[model samples]
Target chain A: MINFEEELKRFFPSLEIEDSEEAIYRQDMTDAADLLLGVIREDYAGYSETPTE
Target chain B: MICFRCGAPLSESDFCNACGVDVRRYKKIVYAANSCYNDGLERACVRDLSGAEHSLKQCLKLNKNHIEARNLLGLVYFETGETAAALTQWVISKNISGTNNLADEYIDRFQSNQSRVETMSTTLKKFNKGLELAQGGSFDLSIIQLRKVLSMNPKYVQAHNLLALLYFERGDFEKARREIDRTLDIDRGNITALRYLNEVNAHLGIPDDKNSKGIRIFDNPSAQVIRSGNETLIQPLNDREPLGLGAFIQIGLGVLIGLAITYFLVVPAKERAAQEAANAELYAYGETIDEKNATISELESRVSALEQNNITLSDSLAQYEGSNGAVDANNYLISAAMAYIDPNQDATQVSEYLELIGDDYVETSSSYEFKELYTYLLNDIGDSVAQNYYDTGLSYFNNGDYTLAISYLSKAYMYNANNDNALYYLAMSYYESGDISTATDKLNTLIESFPTSSLVDKARQRLDEMSY
Candidate 1:
């Protein structure tokens, strides 16, 4: 048996078309270079604290 | 590979052969960049522009001057309708190589067609206007504008993505899905489109597996909550086990029965339903493709029409740019006023410019000021023109050239319709030329227009003589 109120909440009011202006403004394009750089930085940061082999 | 420390080529050993610099890490980086470039090239060959873009970016990060990767990235961008960005990349590539970059060919292709370049410029303007409209809360107008932009550049992924976002904001998940799918078709791994597709699927209640790519991307804590008769049930997807003793037996029996039922009835029924749904979706998509083709046909015709109109407008604009009748008229009026102020200043230039403005301009005008100016100019110069035409007409009439005589006499009558001699000579030219019907019409016009004229008697005499 499905809950009626929960089902109703699934249909959230759509964001206004004007709100897309801010959405686009806030949009940051990310590609694999950024991902690779981030991952490398994270590994480098954690590598210093690792125990020596 | 080259040594980073001393700029010397290295052998296969860990150290540079010439400079003895430790080049292992540098060599590894270069290898990794090459590998990424190779991956990008492979993906680009298969037209996976989105994935190719990503791999190429990673390659450039590792080695900024990876020429082939950079050029391929520009090509991918061009295919996706980012012409400016593609041009920027190719320019950089050309600058880096300076001699034999394929980017040069791409740049040349873009520059070769003037009309196509102008259309691209118009497309970009329309896209920016659409973006402005979307920001200003005019989604319908924005969508219409974006459709035009797409018609101009079908692979414009940004327009498709923005249109999809608008559809999503309108709660039209199906349209949003359609638009996102089109974007993905151009660039298969476009993250924005993929994200939108996930959202649309969720809104449509298409159940995804717990470990699906979209679900794992977010790492949702609660997969789903099953509420059976007001009792909240939590069944962790990762943890399910057989119950103990009688519960296990009953569960096993239930599972067996469920499997039996599924095998016997549900599977074939579900397959049939799925096939029907797929067929319906295919038909709907076919209709959509037909509509798009029709729109493209209409847009092509409209573009040709607009191009022709542009040529005509350009010619008309050149005429305006060369010399304007209105400006000449204003100048003449000013010169005439100046001449009125100074006795020494002659106003012949005024009549000259007024003639340039022409009688057609004066007669069609509804402006009282222009009419007054025209009347003032005409009162000063009109009698002279009528007299000139009368003199020319009589000369031509004496020369026995009735055609030239009628042409000038008609002009004399047009300028000064009250000229009885000009009208009589024009009618006589017509009669002598054997156009008796036109001569009769002209004589009748003369009598009706100037009933008290002395020429009316001669006109009646000619009419009676012609009748004889």
Candidate 2:
């Protein structure tokens, strides 16, 4: 699985992506997971993605 | 002496040493005149108008043939509003230099406004006298004088219009109507008179006929009494059908009887049906609200339980100390809790969850968790609350909406006092809006307070660029 830091670097170009130890340790995996869930919930509510019948 | 052709300083001699020009008798006089001219130019550069005038005058006094000194002295007088002096000096300079261009330009500009100045002064005197007479309650006399002014200057629309208003105030409708008609004749679409004409016709109960160009002068006392009183004078619909008091009483009684039958028979049934429908709607609304409240409470309790489980998993991860799998599991649980406290899903609920999480984090000394929870809490409160203004401002700034960004950023700065991000964005917005001084002050404050921020280098660069 892609790391939270890598996912964030892919989405946000304005954020600086450095390979410092602090960057690796402060990855905030929970925030990443929360953002993913929010996107999924929005897609479901807007009917952009539907469950198979 | 050194020659004027070579631009060399002179000595007390009969000829120029550098350029070989014969400057025998006039060399000393020309040199003194040039020095005075240079001194006047310097004073003019510093905006010392009086000193510049004195120096230029001295230059001309030393050498009456110095045309440049005379021209510059004319400019000084013109700048000081002494138009006559300036014209005289320029005419003399033109004679000395044998050039009509500069003197003619000054004379042309001055002569264009001379007639207009005389007319404006006369009009001002008459307007002031009219005002004094009107203030002393001499309304008819004021109107008469204003009419004379209109006759002299037939296009004086304000005089005709004001005289009409004064006559109207004095209750002389014939005179008022005549003056208003004159005003409208001069300017065909006078909105003021048109509006006053409507009021006059409504008061007199007279239908305005388009073919009548002359003012209607009525001597009928009944029309005058109805015009002056506050009584409603409804015109007769037809000449053959005159209205009587007995017919009015019969019509009023018929309306009263019809209203009584509708109130006694038709309204009770409609009122009963409306009451029943309203009660049924209220019952359904109450049930729905109650169901929603219960569901929300249940969801809240489940979220609290999940949070407790996450806390237990975090404790377990701490006990295991270096177990990667346990830490990953703990991270997933916390992420789920974060998603449950989403801001976009009902902000009030999200705010409640964040408040609870903030309290827990504060008690546990979890500063990292506290910061994340606080940030989310601020965002959930939205721009209506000042704490969320910075986040909203950032969203606007990123969208290139500089005006809205400045509005929200100013509110955020008022709330938090030390929000460097809001201050920086506010300055940028102000700079984009062409407010340079406010932008400079904000940038100065940010540089002083947030030197270690990521935007510090950019702010410093902008400050340097703006300093010049």
- List TM-scores of chain B, every candidate: 0.43, 0.22
Q: List the residue pairs that clash in candidate 2.
A: B1-B15, B1-B16
Which residue window of length 10 is worst by lDDT in model 1 chain B? B209-218
Clashing pairs in 1: none
DockQ, model 2, C-alpha based:
0.00
Query: Candidate 2: lDDT over CA atoms?
Result: 0.61
Per-residue lDDT of model 2, residues B251-315, tens digit only: 99999999998898879889988999999999999999999999999999999999999999888
Q: Can you tell me which runs of candidate 1 are displaced by over 4 Å? A: A1-53, B4-8, B205-468
* Candidate with best lDDT: 1
In candidate 1, what are the lDDT values of residues A1-53, reduced to their tens digit? Answer: 22323322332222222343454345343433345446645766855633243
Model 1 / residue B139 / CA error / Å: 1.4
Model 2 C-alpha lDDT per residue in residues A1-53, reported as the tens digit of each score: 21223322222111111222344244332322233335546756866442343
TM-score leader: 1
